[model samples]
Target: MSKISVLIVTYNYGRFLAECIDSVMAQDCGEELEILVVDDGSTDDTPKVVANFPQVNYIRQEHRGVSAARNTALKRATGDYLAFLDADDYWKPEKLRLQMAYLKEHPECKIVFTAYENFLESSVSAQEEWVKRCCQFAEHDIACLPTALFHRSILNQCGLFSEDLERGEDSEWTYQIWLQKIPRAYMEEKLYLRRLHGKNLTGSGAKQCKEQRKQFQKDIVHKSIRAVRRNNMEKNGISVLIPAWNAQKFIVECIESVKKQKFTELPVEIIVVDDGSEDDTAELAKQAGAVVCKAEHRGAAASRNTAITMAQYSWLFFLDADDRLTEGAFEALYAPIQKDGSLSAVFSYARDFYDLPGRSTNAGEEGKVRTYSGCLPGCSLIRKEVFRKVGPFDLQLKTGETVAWQLKFRNTGLPSCRIEYVTLERRIHENNTGRRMRGQEQMDYARILREHLRQKKKGE
Candidate 1:
């Protein structure tokens, strides 16, 4: 059996077939390689072209989609490693050599992909190289078939391409590969060459690819809903509410910390209100098992109120999208409530982490937790009845709603006390709205305090 199987699926690309096959023949790697060309009822000079190369194994089938053609080749492949080459694209001489070496050295990585250079059909020279992003899950990063060389075992886990999807079958299959957690390595060098030709634009595959991408996105959303439901089937107590705005970068880790909370006494449900985020914050939160709702651009107080209404349980714990709950946050908050049923609301200490030069207001040193008089709302767990009695947050305040509401709720004489135990880690980054509170935000804060003093004056 051959060590590597190079697969090429083509319908009617006779002009590019010989050149694509020649690139495989030109590979300088010292391994036994076999080239398989599967033709899907091409009326062109495809058979005559394959006849020119006696070494190439050519299979002729009825007009099936690219997915079906690739699946056919995948099942019949006899090699240990498989490399797919699109009919119009070819690879560099060192493409197979470098990928094989990397895979052998790193057994933990199941698949490896190389960067590709794109060229116009009229010109042979590639304009530039396609690059990978530094981020783990970049929105625009696309995985192409020619860039990857995979082991035969990956097919067992990821499965073959969808035979129905004509255009984006490869994309859908690649997405499944990522979902299966098959480790992959990306090479920075552009070892593959792609041709940008107009001939393939009018094909059936091209039309199906656009529609298939949307369908694949819907599948991901539905899958996320199912996953969240299955994982969070526990008796719930506290409803963790987060008001987020364009927090795509930090929301994943934030929700992950909440999901990792293993509370024996109080099971929690997370609810996130994405207040007009232009990014994927809502989707990421939902994917992380949080019940998500997207609404118009609103202040934090209003957003939190929306989540409070959607909340399923009694105890409500408010948190920011950029911050994280400590390891035993839910348990610590629940412990006090479990001890004292008369307590309407319980507040805990918070560990503030600062990324800027200055430290948090209460936190003395960087990377440490300290007791602050006015802790963030995330440090408090309040009974839903208490919030209802105190009334929803005042929309007049631009910022400092925590302090303003604390003053207002104090008049109601509800039993509330602060615990010594820290329950939340407040991340103070550049994105912190607290740090950027100025102009209208500052004015609104001053007005709340002024109104509080007026009410105190009347009592005195």
Candidate 2:
């Protein structure tokens, strides 16, 4: 048997298949390494392209899903270790050599993954912060599929890929491995380059990809609910609270995004608080089939308070009407709470999605503040119990309300954990509250700083 079996699953990726194969063939690992390419019935010239690579063990099968293709390769693979690469993605020449060295040195580790750079048309960029935020490199479960390498022996125990899942099969498989408490290692190096062209799976199959994301989120939420139940905690259904005011244009998108979360195992009670919108914000929210609550044109601080009062779940996710949740946001948010009984709340990073020039396309870029005062409300997920004890957003303060609350939490010395995952997307548009109330917001922010100083003085 070979030391490592490289499995490449392809479907209509003739354009990039050659480069992927070449990269694998260039690996310098001295041990026996076999390349297995499973062609998933690509109508394109994928078969012809693979035919040129005589060394590759090519197998053509009917159009099965990627999971099935991968499984076929897995069954045929006769190696001690297994590494999968998508046809549109390629590894560095030393990827196998370096990873194998690391794994051999750390034999206790059953799985390992590395960071990767995204190759777009004529330009290369790091994966979006949102993607990185959802999963940290330090943890294998948080790593993306393209960057992972696993031992074949572990597959026997964890089982093969779920053929039923067309998308997010990697996530499901990784999550299962994590649940087994298998030792995992991280290289922290970019070993693979994932192409993000328009014709790629995520871009070409946008709708299907989206549905898969929704299912993934549901799985995470279900797992969290089970964890909570096992601890004998009160089964508080999750309350997804959105604070909206004159957000007619984006309300539907926001609600639809919430409905897509994969955490279907837990009952989700969505509450959209319409803070007296002159526009049809409430109407739009209701049209989207969300439970709407109306309050006199109050700021977001008041809006969140009203929503919490009506919230059935003890945990609260305060999302803006224009923001959205990424694929595993709910799972990431609930994981910390389930692991640590003392954690009062958790916050993740958020990125701007308005497509402004020079703006970071990666998620959670803006929310990566070194200090507590830099944190924003829309980017956070809070526990209702902590919110109740800390008190609701200060209605008196219109601007920097979130910062003010975070400051209070910091002062009280409560455990406020920051999971570097990007769970929320803050849509930046003309109607953003910051742009709308610029002057007043700045003034309120000044007052908040002054109050913080005064409190510090008294404590001193």
Which numbered prediction scores highest in TM-score against the true structure?
A: 2
Candidate 2 accuracy as lDDT? 0.73
The parts of candidate 1 lying over 4 Å away from their true place are: 123-142, 201-209, 219-460
lDDT of 1 by residue, 1-460 (tens): 2399999999899989999999999997778998899998899999999999999999999987888889889988899999999888888898899888878865766777766775567733232332111111222334566688989999998788877654456656775554565666555467898775655322443344345556655654345335434643222488889999999988888888888888767667788888888999988988888777666676788788767655656678898898877778777777777788888788887777765666454333434444454347678888875664577787767788877787887888888777777777777788678667767677887798798999899878
Scored by lDDT, the top model is 1
Ten contiguous residues with the weakest lDDT in model 2: 132-141
Give the deviation of candidate 1 from the true structure as CA RMSD.
Answer: 14.6
- Candidate 2's C-alpha runs over 4 A off are 122-141, 201-209, 224-460
- Over the full model, what C-alpha lDDT does candidate 1 score relative to the true structure? 0.74
In terms of TM-score, how similar is model 2 to the real structure? 0.50
Candidate 1 displacement at residue 358 in angstroms: 22
